[model samples]
Target: MVHVYTGDTMIETTEEHPFWVEEKGWVLAGELNEGDVLRLKSGENVKVTKLERVDLKEPVKVYNFEVQDWHTYYVSDINVLVHNKAARYNTPTPVNPKRVDTNYLKKNGIDPHSLKYDTLGDGADISKYNIYVDKNGELWILKNGSKEFIPTYESIGR
Candidate 1:
């Protein structure tokens, strides 16, 4: 068993247990490291503080359940949300860009296939352009390097 101390709250579970993350989504406790961030009940981001292994003299029994509607629920006692066993270590599935989505990128002179992708990084640092689409579908160019690239943005939608 592993005791995860993250963002003032802690959870005790197997290394295979998955924890909900903000930008990266579900990640296994074993894969989690200090300096990584997790999400709280209030939708706030919290940094992972530490992790410890438990030496058990006897077996520790744990319970399991099925949540058909939402596979995730909050541990109110610890004030943190966790995904059910069914979603253990679940990562975002790669989806081929839609025709319109691809066309939109191509229209902006971005080669859709040229974009690098790594689920482990969760769509981060994939593009040399440093561009991302906001919730409102607005394209934002984040500042990079020595801050020579002035941050700029434009409204876009599918």
Candidate 2:
């Protein structure tokens, strides 16, 4: 964690290192408060200049990255239909054709339904999946097979 001195008070950076830009708005993480601390990769401690809760109603372009920004949504707020280590054929029957609506997941080359495991084409292991939340409040659908983030967003019905 990096420390930033603002006049007299020294603040400790928060858990997630999220960056915010005014023109593009907050991109990496969730809403930030005034006193919240952030540490940039450059080792500079940044304090939130303003308070904002981002709502990713649609896709927005920020920092040359076309990313989804969610302001009003929280991970817990979304009812995750499935989770770790469950048998695919048992319930929720992993939707085929992989109709996901996320951008980051698609970029990482993950096919949730037709997901291949062990190169034997032996379906996929549900235990290998993980969920991650970005600074922009966007949720990630990831497979543990690779170290990269998936860029596809499957359509999770409302």
Candidate 3:
């Protein structure tokens, strides 16, 4: 049986289902482990009495970006057994271009300077080019001061 911890009460479930615990937040029923403590919705503590691991019908593969190679480690998302040629360690690390240094950007053929933009006095023409860095650190080229952004890589060579 699976138990769900509500803030003020504990409910026993005959089958696996989504469970919410105050301390651990929302989690799938299959993720629960024996001896795990949870706070009920009423702020009472309860321990998981039983847990069973469920085997997935099909295993899933995950991949991370390779900064040195400037591409994903795996050729396809489904191929998880293939090892990354350039990875130095077993731990997975993903590369985000926005967080990289200017030199790194240049090494990857991205010009950090191209991302700079100046205010062209208010009410600028829609066809004007505006280069700016987004919150995620990716560079974008905005045209006509519109919400649509063209990725830096797409416009870099041209």
What local distance difference test score does each model get? 0.54, 0.33, 0.37
Candidate 2, residues 4-114, lDDT tens digits: the string is: 333344433322323322222223333334555433323234454444344456855432222332211111211111112112112121222232333644565534333
The stretch of ten residues in a row with the least summed lDDT in candidate 2 is 73-82
* Highest TM-score against the true fold, candidate: 1
Model 3, span 1-158: residue lDDT tens: 44433333444433333333323433345565665664332223456665545344775453333334222111112211111222221222222323335575576576444332211111223246645444454454455545544343222222
**lDDT (Cα, 0-100) at 100 in candidate 2:** 36
- Per-model TM-score versus the true fold: 0.55, 0.20, 0.24
Candidate rank order under TM-score:
1, 3, 2
Candidate 2 ranges with C-alpha deviation above 4 Å: 1-122, 154-158
- lDDT of model 1 at residue 102? 60
- Tell me which of candidates 2 and 3 scores higher on lDDT: 3
Report the number of backbone clashes for model 2: 22
